[model samples]
Target: MSNLPEARASRNLHKTYEGGSSIVGVLQQYAHDAAPELLRESGVSFGLQNTLDGDPFTEATTPENRRASLLSLAPHTDEIQRFIPLYRHTIHPFVPLLVDIDEFELHVCEYLESRAAGDLRDGSKTLNQWLTGKGINTIAVILATLSCSSYFSDISITERSTTALKFVARAFQALQLANYMLRPSVEAVQTLLLLGNTLQNTGQSDGSWILLGTTIRLAQALGLHAANTKTRGANSRKKEALWSVIVWQDCFLSVCHGRPSGISKAQLKRLNFAAVTGPSLSYFEIMCRVGCLCVDLTEDVPTLKGSVDLVEAIDRCYSNALPHLQSLDKCRNLHQRLEFFALQINMSFTIAVVCRPAMKKLPPGSGEDHYHQFLTTRAKQSLFTTLRTFLAFQALSSMPLRNWSMLHSALTSMLLLSVWEETRHDPQSRDLQERLVGLLLAVSEESSSADTDSDGHPSYYTQWLSPRSIRTLIALQSAIRNTPPLTDHVSPTRSVETLLTTSEGASLHQTGLPVLDSQVPDQITALLGSSVAYDYDQFDWSTVDLSPFAFIDETVNMPFYDSSQSNGFI
Candidate 1:
């Protein structure tokens, strides 16, 4: 279909504005002289017309005729110049009117499609030229109009009665034309950011990320980083500032895209690690992204290489940024950098533990074996140091709200650490296990104290113990149980019971663990196999209700109750 004739005609108006004359001044004069009569003819309130004088047409005119009249006049450069001043002053009041500009654009596009070729084509060229001659502010207004149109086309509101979608496309096209005409100006960056924000708001995260990526590159090319280089005190600092924003944008996009694991790979690759400032900021952003992605367990682990690589990159950043971090002058940014580095390190530890079992093993003495060993050891050490630092920092001051998630994450890491220790017979593993147990106890105590219930149960602590955490804790205890008998260590059964009763314990018996008389599903029973044994008679089943604990009952199609009243038997 041919574009709107009125819209094409309006293009001539844009050309007039682009002629470099005092368009705003001219528009204001025109509005003062002709607005009253125009208002009467358009069937709008004189006051509203006066208020809207010189302003661009928007969506809010009350009567259909008034709105159409305003839009029809919007493309006329001569009429626009006369009221430009009044329009500028009353722009805020006309914001609602702008909403339906998309409808007007559509009307024009449709009209141009049927109109005389000269009027259609000549009008667009004229508006283009006029707009080109105008100042950045004029350009912004034009672009904003176009953006409003695009927004309407992309979104739908069932609650409202209006036809604004058509104009939306035209508005965007107009804005695009303006953007091309004014290349390299800060306006271009603003336009890109606006488009990115629009795409983000509409749930087009990939599109947003792509636009943001382009903006970041352009911002860099234009030397936005150079302005802050002096305050950053190093070339590296400037790069860090630049990459930080890019990483943050990517992180937000990744989070919006259902926490896709490898979404940030392209963004991460663009980071300039050579710059001092860039490393810290880049690492900080990467850590935050990884942490967010980890919590979104819906994401496939196999698609998480981007997150894994991000962690590895953070380690490299830590190595490079640590020396600068030691100096008090750079300590502020350094601390933040380390904090996030530590976070990513912990994430890496968790990912390694989850992925290692499935990972392909290397041949004995092969370079791959050495590489794997190095990663495993580094991940473990990083997890420990990061947790210690994080805890110490928390103890010293009021930590940020987001850091609370880290505590839960640390507990999970401890579980992984125990698993690692069991797999490898390192003597220091015992010390690490002790530290992890202490940390878990402290965390549980803190949680319990903060939210004790009427029944004296630690609700917060219980709630925080998610199924994943429960499984990890059980695995850790089971690992301890499987350890060979030592000279002075207590029995595995006693130790396991003690751990289950500790502050970290909740629903231990209900979580398909090796509890007495608890019916287990075939899958779980298969998992248990002949490795674990259950003594049904060891527990006084008469004293407790085991109905809710039953997974499957063999004798009957339903669960058997112990017929106890005191234990709140289900």
Candidate 2:
């Protein structure tokens, strides 16, 4: 039992202009106040390189072979048509980008018609012609959808990844030709969202996170974040839905990477557009709420009180959303069931992540510390819920394994459980860890069998375990077998004082957040260090919402997707 250093209160800077009654002083004050907002609102670019209009579309560059390749992969119209239903069932239910399948199907038809007309009289078509006749945005979105849906296709794992990449390349080509960076559209935003998720599914989290910035910028350019009272039609609902997804990704990945989010709290609060109803939309809104709770922890000046308040809000949100889950459980088809489990896992994992910093701050010889004990129990319970729901998701379908969010949620919680001192020896925690290890080993063995079918080549199923995930699994296996302290694996010479002085550690401790201690085991630091965003020791939990549905939107109608009645493929 080491103790954390006292929380550091942040220093605030204020400037006063002399002669404030003078016109010049008042003007200076106003300029200082307005400059930051103007820069942010204008969407100015200070970068030297121009992503848009950098290269001209040429015969050699955007050659006919590119189109030939897209056609070769999906040559027939029916082949392209098949992706719509696949997307509706496999991707849309979770991502919910294409809320109306019929509307998207119409766009698919228009794209095909445009492609047909382009083929009639083209000898080195100009870029504008390519953009106009091909319906570049629509084609990009469709290709992106195919890239994502291919993950759940029945094809071999290798084929699934390769096929998905091919479509992704084609989608990029279409965007490049259309100069999507300059000519932003709702369709282009959808394309980027799908492709970003595809990148994540293929174990490219960094790339996906980078791509999200561009997606959010494009979404903002379209005014998707602003609430519109003039229009309440389907299109407006779609805009609000898309904005929710953007915020969700921004906040979610910010916490995952332990970095500052591009979306500020003011923006998040102002862009509160989760007024829609539907199973997927409701789920999306709640997920965004959970993501928002963790955002404060990752800010440059992390605050314990803010983070703790949000953690409790997250708990309340989970409690609030629970009845929504149970209400839908009356007709729990596979899709609804998966959504239920996914939401539960996401909320719980976020709670655990936010609560982790506080776990390390328990006072020495305070076994009688009821608050600390309750916090520890809450964190452990969250980790357990996350893993259990993850298992439920796996039982329903193997698709969860390929989803990046689900994979990270389960892995992060497991890593926390394995390294936390209190949880390492707990019988129930050990049992869950053992069960998880068994499942991983079983999946690895099945993947090996698939390799045998593939003539000794590595199976795509093996891709689900990224190098980082593999390392985590290996460490967990060793820890379970030996039950040794983490120090046996690696030596730590650094002190908590040294950690507090480092720029990264200091950032976490700024503004009333507790600092990490030197006495924390080296192994635990090594395991959970990267994601240790904030300290969370002191909090009043009495403020937590007691009402089941208090946080849910009252205007939302409870409409859920019943898989039995679905006409699309599942």
Candidate 3:
């Protein structure tokens, strides 16, 4: 971390300023801080070339054709009008920007007013019509709308999932022509955030993570991260909000995706607190704290410290964060409560991620005393907590939240619980395992029940509840019930680690999910059907102690989608 470009440049610049106490020192620091973004996004000679493969909007040949293609994919004005506000009310709280509700409403009204004047096809024109109407107001209005559809669709809201897809494609089209990263727009920073968000939600987080770097870089170029004082107005409030959003999101996703956060802790201290007030803001601060821990482990582990010190570092950072993890009732409003729950899912999942590697006493290719049993216990504790918390969120949420991060956390817990049941031979473990699986199945059915067809059958999430995951849950229960309790008659020679390919393997062979028949990802099949031999004698780890979430994120476990088949309006 000390040898990274940002740190080194800052060190040299400070030396040039002779202990860095003068105005020249401050200016140099600012220049040093903003250098990464400029080099990354500006695409200067010798810098890394932009790599955005198969991005729909960027593939278009010419500007005219790009607009035409984008126009061809916009969603209905009515659907956008309906779901965007629901998203603002629901998902927005988790990623709150300094937005004026009244102003946004007016923008929607203007688009509606255009359609009310006369319908292009049936009742309203596509969003592209408004874009073509002129003025930059369209970008601001559309990006907010895009935020709704992108996120909602990802959570399997069938009603508008297709609509969100169209809007996302359109947004990137607008971004392409605007030269958004190098130049600026009226809402460039906000637009970049929403764009990355849409990609993240749609299981394209690699691209989303890449886009985040560009967004943070551009935000810095605009001086959006400067310290703020008491006397601030709406514009100042907006910048502060944007800057906060960049830092919180950059750090949060960096942890999940295993990347370096551009903003260091020292850089974090440079920005004053956001010029806003809300219970959501308070929870946002908590998330930032957890994110910093993630950044620490991502950079430090395996390189800066050995396994034992790594466990202690986890304790020092995350355990002391107990006070920050309060009940949802502490929040003032409904949005804050929801956002707080989302934070809980993130924290628990992150802990499981950080502590998982230490669980295996003798992981593949390790020294004699390779494992820490205490860290293994901590991993299981965090994982079960993750399951219960996600179930609680489902029971409480009126509608299934459409955030990708939240869903991945839920899925991570589900997979980990299944793995735990397969390996453990205890009665209490079996009982608790059955209950959790039942709860998850019920939660999935209920959450997906919201968007149904004429026959009252689910439409969207039906596809996400893959046969493999569903059967894995059911097989876990049966495997628990039918497998004989530890008895003298049963002389077991097989190791628990091999149970993955042996126990679940035989069951999966019987269940015959399409993955077995089709070209499903090897990662999932390898996980469920193959077993890596481990010396169970050396490690006192339970089934749940394994790090299933390590390989999974929003993308790995997410069901496949074909954006080209979208139900377009224009």
Candidate 4:
């Protein structure tokens, strides 16, 4: 699609000032007014008068066709039961959005029973007779769950891909049939979350991001963010749980895209992470804190704009989160440890973003360029930490490849290392870069042997690298091979194995020396796979083109900031 015309005013100025801050719609309107002709050529029709020109809006499917499509897309009740457990195993463990699983199952059983009774009463029945709007919405949620779970099933790659696509199509059609946007429900929001997450995992991040925005809006409409005494009970718990996932997703994706988060800080404050008290914090509670810190680090939008220094923001958030990170170290369960691995990478990646603007050239003969030096060091160290933790995560588990956030973080960190001249050439960063490249190539080769898409190319997720990203990695590897290693390198006295066996929970400084700070937490020690020591007091913490009408894949290696002009870096 053609790029929209550049706005004469700031994009933020386009907010609607009613209901919610509808920035994107207003901006699109601005684009239409400014250059309708250009947009017309790019397949964007302007007015209702142009409906005859084959506008997508004008082409609506009849109710009969819609019912047929939903039926074709939906699997049998037994199949749905099978997929639900797969979803619970693979996706729900990480997200945990669909809290009322028993209720959802009840809905499915009731719908099936009702449909059977209706069919017996009459040989022919309308769509509404078979399923109500709410019923359809329920099925949409089921289909969305199936769409995501299909990848992890023990099916052939071709069958898996086809099945997933069918689920996605059916889920989307069911949502329309249910009029979910017009008459929203808890199930509607759940469906959106499941479908959005499915799209994200399959490399349709742009669509996934857009779907999340809609989910947040619908969630607000349902008053999920409000912590009211009247809204107490199982329903309230479900709302709060769903909202947490929304906050986590909004903050993380916002940081990744270099955009302001849809979930504001005030909204997050209302959730009150402090009230989530327990002797041992569950992964849900832990994830909420991680999400909130991400917002604290990067989501400073309508507030003070450029007045708050990014470095100060990073420090403040990191300081606040140190205690939580420390506490997480005590967790020994395999599940919680996996959660910690995700938290560690997310924290490191978020901090790296705060320092990304500073990843430029240092001034020549400057003794006191701490601002540049500090941030540059942070960006490199954090990016390296992200890659290193991700590597450790992969070694420790096999299912993490299905963890979309980790995969995105790993690919993104590698992309930054490939593009950022400073860390790209740093001797300290080369070993991890080489290791990551080798791992990615191995994954790609593995996928090539078993999983080829319709185009005969390895599926992007299975291959674990986009073509552009892979090329960049190969070039980076070649550069690393040609570059001479630093002559002043010092070998460590203790190997990782010795350290692991000698000390159960030892905190190593950035220099690989064990930290003697009695106050420092063991969690910080085990945060990264590397020996890099970070002081909590000092630092901060925080395309596929498969089809013409398909969503665009994420630019996994794109820079956090679109332009260096904003940060004054050449």
* Model 1: per-residue Cα lDDT at residue 307: 36
User: Which parts of model 2 have CA positions greater than 4 angstroms off?
Assistant: 1-78, 99-101, 112-130, 229-233, 273-281, 300-305, 319-324, 327-331, 364-371, 452-472, 480-570
lDDT of each: 0.37, 0.57, 0.52, 0.57
Candidate order, TM-score descending: 2, 4, 3, 1
Q: Candidate 4: global Cα-lDDT?
A: 0.57
On lDDT, the leading prediction is 2
Q: Which ten residues in a row have the lowest lDDT in candidate 3?
A: 10-19
lDDT of 2 by residue, 335-420 (tens): 67777777777777777766554555544786535655555677788899988888878887766677888877876666566556
TM-score of each: 0.36, 0.68, 0.61, 0.63
Instruction: List model 1 lDDT by residue over 1-570, tens digit each.
Output: 222133234332221111113343344456766674342333223221122312243433333433233234233333222323232222211122222234434533433332333332333443332333122223343444344333323122210001122232333344443333323333344445445543433323356666666666555444443333235455445444434444444444443333443333444443443455533433343443443333333244332244345446545544444433323344466344444444443444445433432233344565355445555555556556545544554453323111222443454344444434323334454444455444544554454455545875433224323232233344434433343333334443333234334422333333323332222222122222222432233322222233211211221112112123233211
Pairs with steric clashes in candidate 4: 314-540, 318-541, 509-533, 510-532, 510-533, 543-553
Residue-level lDDT of model 4, residues 289-396, one tens digit each, is: 667665754544212222126546544444444344434565567666666676678767766766654643444775536566676677678888898888877886
Full-model lDDT, candidate 1: 0.37
Q: Give the TM-score of candidate 2.
A: 0.68
lDDT of 3 by residue, 232-351 (tens): 888777666567677777866776666678776665776564333333335555555445445565464452125446546544444433233456555676555666566677767776
Model 2: lDDT of residue 81: 62
Winning model by TM-score:
2
| Candidate 3 lDDT (Cα, 0 to 1) | 0.52
